[model samples]
Target: MNIKIPLPASGGLLLSYKCTAACRHCMYACSAKWKADWISEEDLVNILSQLAGKILPSPYGPDNIGLSHGLHFTGGEPFLNFELLCNALEIASGFDIPSVFVETNCFWCTNDETTREKLLTLRGKGLKGIMISVNPFYLEYVPFERTERAVRIGTELFGYNAIVYQVEYYRRFKALGIQDKVSFDKYLQLENRTDFARNTEFFIMGRAPYRLTEELADLYPRYPAGSLVHMPCSPPFLRDWHNHFDNYGNFIPGFCGGITLGDCRELNDLLKNGIDLEEYPVLAYLIQDDMLGLLQFTVDRGYMVNGDGYYSKCHLCVDLRKHLNAVDGFKELKPDGFYSNLA
Candidate 1:
């Protein structure tokens, strides 16, 4: 189970503290509804000021990409702050050292030519390209045309540039539109490479924090709370985060930080006024230490826990509400097979 991979050499940069669309399944439902515990643009500037001796700003004068240790711009929707995103990229470009990646929904990639042009341009200017995140749920709001356009822009326009494009399919419900899922699958299939197994992920968490309706808790028809599930989070900050809870209180790692499950003994001081109750609305966070993990998980590490087996890993503090609505078995919509080494 110890799938040791390379240490993350990059940082998940919070570009803009906002998103445009409010997808139902968004783990935190990350919209204008919340703000992350990030150093501000000014804070970044100050950090840069102190680290000037170690790094440089973008290759483009006053350009955003130049300055950084390596960085990835993810958020409510990093593209929302396209200008700030560009500025950050300029800063990275200045340093000319980091390989930056953007985790985007790809919705905007198709609508605006300016955004498209900027992404394409970044390919040459040290931009690592996009992580075109797609899934069956995405089809609800993300039109087929847009997802297709995103692929074209990321692969074709960027000239088959470096990109991640993680996709996940759900097969739990037979009610979801078949055609929409099919179209989405085909789109991701084309984007996947031979080495990579799947272009998607089923790692639960996002907006709609665990939706445990009476119907869903019936995984075995009679039993409730079902079985536990867990995934190991590979963020360098995991132990650091776990320690936060053990010594202080029931909590989450800063990397996957969301809601704290118990008393806010020490974390309150680190956060704004109080714990980030706004983003993580799960009651699981308030659970006792021993049972805190009943509803938690981290990504990058593996194991598929389900109704038959017990849950694993710490997921309570994070938002898993959306995934709680149903588990995916993904079959009829199989357009492509993601090449996972294990799979």
Candidate 2:
């Protein structure tokens, strides 16, 4: 069946791929290794214009009340480009788009007053909320204090609008007396368990599959490419609830990172006419026959599968996409840096 993802009801824009931290679980593989490539004002406006009224009611609001707008500003970290982020919030406001928020790792939350000032500035620019990331991965780079301060002030300012991505991790870190950053190894040591990912919403894709094979081994065992299950990724690909448009103008369907459905620059036409599988050969194969289709396609292009096997079908898909991105130059495998930065 041809794949045509429904218009997104909830999503964010990745302002850039450059992040302060190179987290092991980063699905986008965002890190300092990336160049300083923030999204242009033109592209941002174009994307927001197309998405302004297409969104459905937001699930985050009460009875789908006043906060139904589902647009958000994100990036390797939206705070990295404070001016651009402010502009983004203002632009969304001009479009009468409410409930707009920003996602961050809180690397910029150096002091309480400073953080409060920035939050207030954004809020004044029509910002609705904020989501501060709190996980073992983020703990590896950002101090626990920064995240703590951001959440505290955000809650004070936005009330229930302040969100902690997995409040469980926030509570866990506090209970363990983690005031500063902890190394990944030490985090595991303190937790007294290796299967921490099992407790969180971990996806075995992108940098996770490459960096966390050992940590996630017991929970998701590896299987040979030939022996692994072959099912279409449509379930995740077709997910219309949340999708993202990247600074590179790639329409990232759901969380299938590095896979672009079509260019967001041409979003209006794509949405109106629907997508043609032939235009996205890699997406076509994944939608039609899953990794096996990509596996066969890559093999024909002189690629060899690792004898050691893979953690999951998504893992296999990433590896195959990496190979294709390097050799075949599939337009759908966008932001060539996404694959290169994995190493």
TM-score of each: 0.51, 0.93
**Cα-based lDDT for every prediction:** 0.40, 0.82
Q: Give per-residue CA lDDT, model 1, range 9-88, as digits (tens).
A: 33344443355545544543355544433335654453333223322223432223311224456665776666666666
What are the candidates' C-alpha RMSDs?
13.0, 2.4
- Candidate 2, poorest ten consecutive residues by summed lDDT: 60-69
Off by over 4 Å in 2: 1-3, 60-69, 215-220, 232-235
| Clash totals, every prediction | 64, 0
- Candidate 1: deviation at residue 272, Å? 23
In candidate 1, how many Å is residue 201 off? 2.4
lDDT of 2 at 247: 95
Which residue pairs of candidate 2 clash?
A: none
